[model samples]
Target: MSATTPPNAPQGLQNSIISFPDPGILLVLINRPKQLNSLTVEASYELDSVFQWFDNEPSLRVAIVGGVGKAFCVGADLKQWMSNNKKGIPMDLPTNGFGGISFRHGKKPIIAAVNGAAYGGGCEMAINCDMIVASASASFCLPEVKRGVTPFGGALPRLMRIAGRQRATEMALTGRPVTAHEFKEWGACNVVVERGQDVVDRAVELAKLVAANSPDAVIITREGLKMGYESLGVGDSSRLFLEGWSKRIYEGRNMQEGLDAFTEKRAPLWMDSKL
Candidate 1:
């Protein structure tokens, strides 16, 4: 790699593997399959660093995260949580939340590849991703309540927004596993990879499409979308977007290249996102 080119993956990543499956696209695999991809606090923090690096790396415009085994993530390590509680430790999540994604507000977009069962924090991570592609056999649930806890990993409110109050309440209260198709109906899962297909491959395909676009637009447009998704009113969101990223985007060279390419009827040659 050139001095200007960042390493393929961030250093100090022991719990996850990062691969560049396409230009400007990153694929993250949670390495723990034996524990059903359960995360301890340390693992969560380590993944947090990985994503933090992803955000700062100019070349990586999109990310697809999945597990290595039959589960995306089963949430925190319960045994570790119990032990920490007994030892007077908080057993809390990093600011980025479970697997460094549930509460992430990053500059770029991430897609969740739900290859298998996603429970507790795992489900929350998938819930908050910019998009999700789940295999037909994938399952989802928030089972914390059954273990004398609540789904406190930022899934509750986001679920209400995506799936609505009634549906969210039904899933939260019941703590029962649901199929990928059911989640699709709830508007939580974007696409269900049919049987005999790979969820991560589908996610990577989606990521490559996004990566092929003007990287600056992808990031700023994603910010605008989030402002619309999370903010109260469309008018206010538009104003905020115009005041913020809209100005930064116009100042960037990619915007001009995109306009020029369109005018010339040629494909845009976009640079890595600098916005």
Candidate 2:
């Protein structure tokens, strides 16, 4: 539902998500247990909106995404795919692509708290996040090849960027499950927890650390770093970005509060006045 609604509010079919503000972190959980938390058309649109919401919310510097069922996500509904294929009609996809937030970039950081097997599009979902903290029981794979298709949701390309060309090739060609520990070793995930300990808790811990920083600074740094790495050619762009933020920060009250708090030896009370 509505972002203003509490997380414990009744869940609906179209809105199978529960989001609440936890200090500087926005806790988002998928509430679809049936179909293994499969992403529906409505859910996809809601996710796009959610990304925009998070982007505008200056108080929320970090986001933690997790699923409610035994698996994070099983990808698209095969029955729907078959039905549409039979009728010679293509499904209307969200603007960001296969899954709502898979191929898009946001201004803030999102940490995937993967608690179980993430396959096909699910794997892409996890990879889309800035970082991942997975449970020991968690596994990841892009097995679209086995189904006579390919993982088109940035899976192939993102995996290659994170895990290197050789590892990405092996995972894509084999369609085999990669354990969370192996993924950690491959630099695919940030941390791997034991099966019993709450992986979400681990993610929250990391989120809190990120939330401790200046929200604007965090957003600007992430944007600058991402652009610098992805740019075809880079030079004065970094300087331009810093200069732009330098001007914006001074215009906002938060920057002055940050300086005041530093001198006073206290934590700055931050609010998203822009929102």
Candidate 3:
């Protein structure tokens, strides 16, 4: 099923569609198939709002992003960019960055269900997601340098940290596309689906697995993982992480439910995270 707008969703969404595909899971699909899911400036800001709403909504635990057509997202609307340039307008991205996924430091976890070419900012989005589940046919590339523009949406450092400098350098300099399997080897892709498997279905299954766990653990653990990637030293990372999250998780009702359920051999009845 295609993504559709919610009755009271954040406004200004001319593109990108949102829906609750499963219990506790929000699905955001990039809907510009004819344009290969390239995002216009207005659409970029609107998506930032969408994700902000996702993070704020208590019932939603996980989000999956995918494309409606042959490409996940090819990045900026360059045609629009050139038009804006001719008119002296700036094509500024939202503070949350591309599709509100790249450069996002949100509290919740997001999973990218890559079905096709996740080029440019699309690749950026996948790289920044807490996890990625990609189709075998999916490919990733950063062709910004080739287009006479740099990937200014905060992906370079993150990509270099995740995929290593050599691999990152090669992809950026040559704009070479890497297959899903190869990216999995680079530690960029979490799961590479086999041919004929539906990427979104696989991603939904994974998202539900996360949603089933304690929401507090999911957020706290996600913070720890992000710290590992972004922090220079574990001392500072652990100190800051502990100061903020350690108390909340330990004191949270879900923690008690989790341990009690495990001891009793029963399913956990988790509460929504108050963190």
Tens digits of per-residue lDDT for model 3 on 25-100? 8888999999999988887887888889888876778899999988898887889989999999976788888888
TM value for model 1: 0.96
- Candidate numbers sorted by lDDT from highest down: 1, 3, 2
Instruction: Give the top-scoring candidate (TM-score).
Output: 1
TM-score of 3: 0.94
C-alpha lDDT score of every prediction, in listed order? 0.89, 0.77, 0.86
TM-score of the candidate numbered 2?
Answer: 0.88
In the range 1-275, model 2's lDDT, one tens digit per residue, is 12354343334436456465456677667666677767766676776667667777655678888888787777777777788889997767777765566886777888988988888878898998888999999999888889999888888887887899999999999999999999999999999999679988899999888887777667767777776645434666667666766677667777788899999999987756462
User: Which regions in candidate 1 have their CA more than 4 angstroms from the true location?
Assistant: 1-5
Task: List where candidate 3 sits over 4 angstroms from the true fold.
Answer: 1-12
* TM-score against truth, every candidate: 0.96, 0.88, 0.94
Candidate 2 error regions (>4 Å): 1-15, 232-237, 273-275
Whole-model alpha-carbon lDDT for candidate 2: 0.77
Q: Say which prediction, candidate 1 or candidate 3, comes out ahead on TM-score.
A: 1
